[model samples]
Target chain A: MDILVFALCLAIGIAAGYRNWLPPYLTSRSSWGLTAAVYLLLFLIGCELGSYRSVLEQMSGLGVQAAALCLGGLLGSALLCRIVGGGGGV
Target chain B: MFDPKPILVLLAGVILGAMGHLPEGFDDLIGPLLRGALILLFLAIGFDMGKEPRLWETLRSLSGRALMMPVAALLGSVAGGILTGITVGLPVGLAASASAGCGYYSITMILLKEAAGIEAATIGFVANLAREVLTILAMPLFVRYFGKAGALGAAGATAMDTALPFIIRSAGKEVAVHAFVSGVILSLIIPLSVPLIYRLLS
Candidate 1:
């Protein structure tokens, strides 16, 4: 459901943009809007995280497992993309 | 941390939250507000993408090859999951589900809680959050060491938004297109993949 919303909203925005339907005021400030939204999101995320006191309290116990998987996933993808991705100038 | 401003804002929020500074009813509103913010963020990003002079042309040039980045992300994340399962002594499905969250912590946690339980959900939350934070912190280094595709792959589903600025800063604008496409693809895959893999394997 959330995925559908994400794709739908983005598609709507894209279509509106293609059609020049966005107001001039919005188009001019879109970058700032994007950045502000991201910061707002980060703040919300932090609030969400900090509110989960149980998670924070139990972090020590969960830390090792989470870290291992996180590092492994990140490194594995890094290597794999290097091997298979041709960098695609990505 | 080339860009510490966002991180600082995040820390401020965390501090306040930890202090129980939220007004009454605010906690309940977080989820809905988060969704609203995400929608706005996506629309903004999509607008920029569409506004590009040669949007379709750029995407067309990327073509099928762009799809490979998501595949790489999946394979790599699975490999990580397997190792986590072994080392952490978690069930195969549980570990895979958590690791496969692809930096999408919120939905992944909710889904895992329903499907697997709070323990799996916790792991999913931590693991996915770690992916995003790690991507943000390591992006510059990844671009320097792993090149553009590696950076994009490391970002998983976050490359579209949270991790994009870093990619754009470290890599050029050209790579940003692939990053956004890869992010969108991975984002689509994660919700389906996380629970399905759990149900199938567990």
Candidate 2:
């Protein structure tokens, strides 16, 4: 059931892409759509965080380990880019 | 005017969480919302792809760079997983799964829930979500310093849909196309790769 829903959503996205409906939003001089989307997502994130307040506290209690994982992910990605010579124009 | 979808879905999640909803029911709603969000995001990416006139030229110019992006991403995933496992003392597989999870936060969360239970899934989801935020904030610096290939590696599969407009804005149409193709390829691998990594490490 979940897979079916995922496939359906992906199909819709592909359809939208092939049909060319996103450029106007991207190139719009006014930031209406973009701002709305960003803000909405941000608010959603905030709400989720708020709901997970206890979990956040618990995770933070885990201390340096959690922080290390986050930093490691970032540094690892950056290092990989440098090593692979990915630091050039596409 | 504010777009309602993100807000609505978020509100729904919050309300449910506040109400102390169980994982099974929340899972049902989250699946649909995530799928809906991805569809909308992907559609926008497709539209952006349509506007690129320099796609062919860019592809021609960066063929070599394009090939390197995924290799970089794969390396990043492995390195991240290893480092995290060492630091957190979690199983290397779980760490690796988290590292390779990309920006598919909801999907990763869903997978973690099914495989490891709700608590583990939530942690993975938050970590993945943080990764997305970091990707959005840091993408420009990467593009400036490393160029399109760097940015593509940094963005991973997110380059296709969520990050498509930014790539278009930062590097132009050709780069965006390259990123989009790379993103699609990465997304295909993530679902299988994350699970495999977890299984192997465990």
Candidate 3:
């Protein structure tokens, strides 16, 4: 059931995007329709995270791991950029 | 420069969750909401991409530089995983999460639940979430110091959405397309890389 709902939402979003409806929302800065939709989605993500706060606290010990991942990702990305000769010139 | 919508939504979710008073069917709301949000985000990304001037010219220029972003991201993910594994004295899933981009939160949480249980899943969730936030915040700086290619790498998984607009605005169309393509590719690789690294290390 949840999967179905997700699929439906995804399909709708993609369809709307493929049709180029989202652009007008931003260009016009219209508040009533698509802007509301975008805002709603952002809010939902925030809510999801907030709902999981207890889990977040319990897992607080993973902070070091998080920091390491951030640094490692940055460094690794840099090296890759250099090796590939892609990022150096940009 | 933080957008207030996400903050408000997060607060709303927390409050609703705390109340613990949702009706019987209320549980069904989450899936649709999240899916809808993701679609909106993606669509916004595509729409913005379509509007960039001289989009092809920028893309043509980025062909060389864009190739390096994923490699850099992969390296970062591995480094992160190893550090976490050593510190935690357990096979931390940092590699996958870092490599996968922000998508790690959803995929890692699922994988952690099945492989390591609830505790590990929670850690993966938080770690991935932090990575997403960091990517968003660091994108402008990376673009400034390292240019479009660097910004693409720094954006990690969010290059297609959160960072795409800024990248397009700053570096022009080619860099934006490069960042988007690179981000999508890296995001796809995250799931495979996370478990692969964990297995290799453990």
- lDDT score of residue B82 within candidate 3: 56
- Give the distance in Å from residue A12's predicted Cα in candidate 2 to where it truly belongs: 19
Interface RMSD after interface superposition, each candidate: 4.7, 6.0, 5.9
Q: Give the fraction of reference interface contacts each candidate recovers.
A: 0.59, 0.33, 0.35
Model 1 stretches with alpha carbons more than 4 Å out = A82-90, B62-67, B82-86, B89-202
Q: Determine which window of 10 residues in candidate 2 chain B has minimal summed lDDT.
A: B41-50
Report the number of the highest-DockQ candidate. 1
DockQ for all candidate structures vs. native: 0.45, 0.24, 0.28
Best by lDDT: 1
lDDT of each residue in A1-87, candidate 2, tens digit only: 243444454455445445555555445522354334434443344344445657556666434443444556655665676567545
**Superposed model 3: Cα runs more than 4 Å off:** A1-59, A86-90, B1-68, B84-99, B102-104
Candidate 2: docking tier: acceptable
Clash statistics: count for each candidate: 0, 2, 12
**Weakest ten-residue segment in model 1 chain B by summed lDDT:** B110-119
- The candidate with the higher TM-score, 2 or 3, is 2
Candidate 3's C-alpha lDDT? 0.53
Q: Ranking by DockQ, best first?
A: 1, 3, 2
Which pairs clash (backbone N, Cα, C closer than 3 Å) in model 1?
A: none
